[model samples]
Target: GESFDPRSSLYLYGNGDGPTSTATIDFAAATGTEYADEVENVSFRINDIDWGSGNHTDVVTVNAFDA
Candidate 1:
């Protein structure tokens, strides 16, 4: 399921390689204000996360909309 409201808040997405480590996603909004800007791919970085004991891959989905 997607977050109910993503535009007004900061959406953090992530994925994990294994139980040893995890990855984080970073996004750059077209502009600082959510209402006056469009969303773009920006970029992402991996951060403290877990991949569930190397058994399955973790994926994070972000839901963004015009505020």
Candidate 2:
């Protein structure tokens, strides 16, 4: 269910936490030109463990550097 975004950094992702705040993710410091040089698939931990044993696939993109 991955789609494309022209201005990804302008958008914010929430509720990345898994099951009662087991996991939390944050996106910052984007350096992309119209979604090209973006940071994809930022990593996080689930209750200090693996994210749902690879069952979860939550990712974010960084695209703050634009004209």
Candidate 3:
């Protein structure tokens, strides 16, 4: 989605048929330490996409707030 941050993106090289030489990342170095069972709730949205294909699926749960 448009709101998904570029910094948090996962890149895969040699998927074949790309613009040019793709970049890579070291996942092990990225995820440091063992799981601490730390759970946090965050809000995200999907936008600017053509859902006409209906090829993917996801359940969106919105948090209602009164202002």
Candidate 4:
């Protein structure tokens, strides 16, 4: 398992007028260190979703690599 700074967070806000939205999070910037070369697993914690109405649905997609 790995640990990250509790204060580290990435937020992306979309205007709700587009079919898709995108953002990038630099792990080195967020953790103050580069990701290890052998890393095989990564995880994310998502919160504070603003489902304005009861009929709204959201999909989250994440892509990670050793760039």
lDDT (C-alpha, whole model) for all candidates: 0.46, 0.41, 0.38, 0.62
**Per-residue lDDT tens digits of candidate 3, residues 1-67?**
3366667653333322323333432223225767543434444444432223333322233444432
Which is the winner by lDDT between candidate 3 and candidate 4?
4
Model 1 TM-score is 0.23
Q: Best-fitting candidate, measured by TM-score?
A: 4
Predicted candidate 4, C-alpha RMSD? 5.8
User: What local lDDT does model 3 show for residue 36?
Assistant: 48
Q: In candidate 2, which residue pairs get closer than 3 Å at backbone N, Cα or C atoms, i.e. clash?
A: none
Candidates in order, TM-scores: namely 0.23, 0.20, 0.23, 0.43
Query: What is the lDDT for 66 in model 2?
Result: 31
Q: Write the per-residue lDDT of candidate 2 for residues 4-66, one digit (tens) a residue.
A: 454543323345444433233344456753554346655422222234545354544334343
| True-vs-predicted CA distance for residue 49, candidate 3, Å | 3.4
By TM-score, the better pick of 1 and 4 is 4
Off by over 4 Å in 1: 1-54
Off by over 4 Å in 3: 1-5, 10-35, 53-67
RMSD of each: 11.2, 13.1, 11.5, 5.8
lDDT of 4 at 63: 78
Clashing pairs in 3: none
Task: Find the 10 residues in a row with the least total lDDT in model 1.
Answer: 16-25
Residues 1-67, model 4: lDDT tens digits: 4667789777676555544557776544435556553444567777766555653556677776665
